[model samples]
Target: MNTFCLEVSGPFACFTRPEMKVERVSYDVITPSAARSVFEAILWKPQIRWRITRIEVLNPIRWINLRRNEVGAVVSTRNVQQAMNAGSGYLGLDIEDERQQRAGLFLRDAAYRLHAELALSPKANDPLVKYAEMFSRRATKGQCVNQPYLGCREFAADFRLVAASAAERPAIDETRDLGWMLHDLDFTYPCAPQPRFFRAEMKNGVILVPDFETGEVKS
Candidate 1:
């Protein structure tokens, strides 16, 4: 089976059931890229192929934010162990739960843009931004304004994924606002969600990445 790996680094936290309090927690993970892609397509398209295998954390634990508004505080976990400890802080939740919920933010954001890009203009180079703007409008409903966090240090995640056969993935519908879907996701913050990713290959391998360019360009 074709597979890819995803690396995501950022603060992770869990919200109180229905409270959604932003917490300070950080972590990192490397897992099957297919799984990451599938998680990305979660609310957007169920027809997509990709399943998470395992998730490994890499970093130190730390608390960052505790906001509860449109731009909730962004936090990062020191490492997997810290995240696990935070997860354990909760009664029935585990470390993986925290990671899933934290990942939900990125997944929702990416999925929303992916949907808009295919619907409005698949040819657009920056579909994610376009979709994010669209959601910002709707986010005003619950006083939760969808603020743009592109390059915003406050809310950012460093993640990578591996996948195969992009053709197998289904296109997203533009007529929908995936922001709400993300908002509805169980990992709305403070609530630990089950992990959907895991480790793939331990050691890194060298690759001769090709620099193919038919046209010559001047710097």
Candidate 2:
């Protein structure tokens, strides 16, 4: 397996807990799915899949409260489809009328080191040397198809390739259980998405991720 490490940091992040539907509440640390998204932002293809193995918390967990103005309603998809088909009616959302203020609890001064492995699907052309080198080159050059964010687009993440030997030591030392956290979403059946979760624990600032297929994941 070809593995890689990346150092990612941001001023603010909110990996919103699914259970918290009204107000935004973030996880103590980065989730496996969020870490995988960062990698995918750097380099992604249908043939190549990135699997997160571990997340090392490089900074102490801190929380901050913030209030943001957000629109409450979404533009109806039916309206959008009707406009696309018949070119009539309003399909845009009016923020001034629907805007609402909401409170959010987010992680402040967050930093994490991600470790992941790459797997090639049957559609891959050159499984070993092709995509691996492409990802390494893109990461070193700070090239991402889109700007990577911690959880929200407003909080941008800075990423760079880090050697395993030179990786920074995690600042946290105590062991704590983070309870059940989101692992990733299963999109195999696109019509019906499935949410998967696993028990999360942090030991010496490292959160080990279980295999998506074999691990103790609940949907």
Candidate 3:
């Protein structure tokens, strides 16, 4: 029952994990609390439990008014053939090009919708509030009850995990695993160290936070 916080901002979009095949994408503007809850829905925990308690938007919520860029409509030849294949299951590369292009158009439209919603709101000065309002509006407009498109300006996630047993936990230096890589140069060495945030536990779930500051990790 522990709670976490997430803050999101800047040209943000949410997509299901690559492994989860899905249809009918939706969109939403949400608060940290709501975001956390949604995140846990996709990622959850038993040994390491976390929930989103609150969320704050850091940038102006601009609803993207996106139209299909003609360039995007051209599905790769490979994708078209695969879409017609029978063994590809739900996710066939054939639809990738087309789906990707359609996604781009949807994002553009969603961004414009967000911006328009915020423009009419009196609290537009507060980017977080504006984004939340926009999300709520989209969620309602899209009639997306379980899932919706999520776009935020800047998003932060505050989380907690079960503290390792103080005694069993070794000193930081001694705890180093070969998984951590010091640098690209180190990759040439015997073994690369893993990230400090890497977790060995199987029960933990990840929260999706907007990378507004970094401008990386697109939806």
Candidate 4:
């Protein structure tokens, strides 16, 4: 496997639980998909995909409550399609009319070390090392297609390539059973929502993430 690691940290994060229909509740630790997103931010290619293997919590998990403003209604694709079909060529959502306040339980001062590997698609022609080196070089130089966020884009995350020596440092001395958490989404169409969950346990501050193909993830 072509493997690499990154150290990611953020002031706040909210990996919203699927069960929370009303209020947002964050997972005890970052999810595999979220970790993959950090890597995707640095570099992404259609020929390669990321698989998060493990996560190390460098700082103690701290919880904080917040009430954030959000829009209750959104302009969906159907709305845009309808507008285009009618030749109106215009659509708008008044935030003031749809604005809502929601509570969220988020993690504060969160930091994690991500370990992941790449899987080259059948169409890929180059060796895995080439892409691995590309990612490492991009990360080291602080290059990214977009700014990586922890969970919410408002809570931005800072990430960098880990050094071989400093990478060996252990995570915070702690352990806990985090219960079933969202593993990843199975998008039926263009990033549509279909969530999967898995039993989460943190041992010595390290969380083991399952591969997407594993039976551990439940719909």
Candidate 5:
């Protein structure tokens, strides 16, 4: 299996904590789910999926607070279905009326080096090289299907392909147990997303991800 290396960074990021009820609070580092989303933004296919192996934190973690206005309620699905059925129904949210002020604790000046491998889905028939070459070309040319975001859609992320030789960038020297971090969500049920977690330990600024499917921790 070929491992792809990428360096993604942004001014602000919020991998929102699941425990937070209202105000947005971010994790110390990027979540694996968010990391996977970044790669999918660059190149994605139904035949293959990304599995993050490791994350190297290059910059020291920092935080900044911000208060912003956003809508509180979503347009009900019933309203959307009605709109589709009637050709024209109320499918819009009155932003002015639903607007509420919320505070967010977000990361600032964040940067990380991510390593991931592609896992072939049951639908895959093409060789691995085909997908590897496709990803290399797109990453080299900075081509993406859609703009990649750090955590929220508003905070855009910048990325680049890191050559194998240049992939030796050193991570900061730090060690801490981050408790149980949300690895990703199980989307088996399209409507109801289930959260998954694993014990996260950042040693020497590097977080080693486990095989999420097998429940085996990496040594």
Candidate 6:
């Protein structure tokens, strides 16, 4: 399998815990899904899927508290469909009426090195080298389909491509258990999406990600 590496850094990040409904709380480190998203932002194709293999934490984990005004409600899907069909029903969120101040705990001055491999689907026709070169070229030129974020769109991430051998190792030496962290959401059955989680442990500032298929993920 052909693998790639990227170094990502940001001023702040918030990998929000789904279990925390009221207050936004982030995981100690970046999740596998978030790492994969960073790669996809640089290069993604329907026929190719990016799988995160490991995350090297280059900065010590630190937390900061922030409070921001957010809208309480999202645009209703039913209302959107009604508007599309008959040009009726409210489709916009009333921030004045649904504004709420929420507290968020986010990572401060975060930096990580992400390692991932490309898995070609059956529909893929191009050779692996073609896609790999494309990604490398794009990344070197600072090109992305969209600005990659650190869990949240408001927090933009800086990314650069690096050789797998030259990638930086973790800066910390402590072994800490991160508890159960979100792996990704399974959407094979679209109507009922399944959330998967795995036990996370950071050893020597490196968080090793397991295979999605064989990894022990609890729904």
Candidate 6, 43-120: lDDT as tens digits: 889888898998889888899999988889988888888888996667777779999999999999999888899878
Candidate 1: tens digits of C-alpha lDDT, residues 23-88: 322221111222233234322332222233333223322234343323322344445457687785
Local distance difference test, per candidate? Answer: 0.28, 0.91, 0.29, 0.89, 0.90, 0.88
> Which is superior by TM-score, 1 or 4?
4
Over 129-207, each residue of candidate 4 has an lDDT whose tens digit, in order, gives: 8898899889999999999999999999998888672636789999899998888888756667788888989999989
Candidate 3 residues 122-203, lDDT tens each?
A: 3234444444443444433433323322532222222222122222222112121222111111122347632111111111
Per-candidate count of clashing residue pairs (backbone under 3 Å): 42, 0, 44, 0, 0, 0
lDDT of 2 by residue, 114-158 (tens): 999999988888766788999999999999999999998889999
Off by over 4 Å in 3: 14-28, 31-34, 37-44, 68-92, 96-219
For candidate 6, the TM-score is 0.94
Q: How far is 117's C-alpha from truth in model 3 (Å)?
A: 30
lDDT, candidate 5, 78-157, per-residue tens: 88998899899767888999999999999999999999998778899998889988998999999998988889999999
RMSD of 6: 1.6
TM-score of each candidate structure, all chains considered together: 0.26, 0.95, 0.26, 0.92, 0.95, 0.94
Q: Model 2: runs farther than 4 Å from truth?
A: 87-89
Q: Alpha carbon lDDT of residue 32, candidate 5?
A: 93
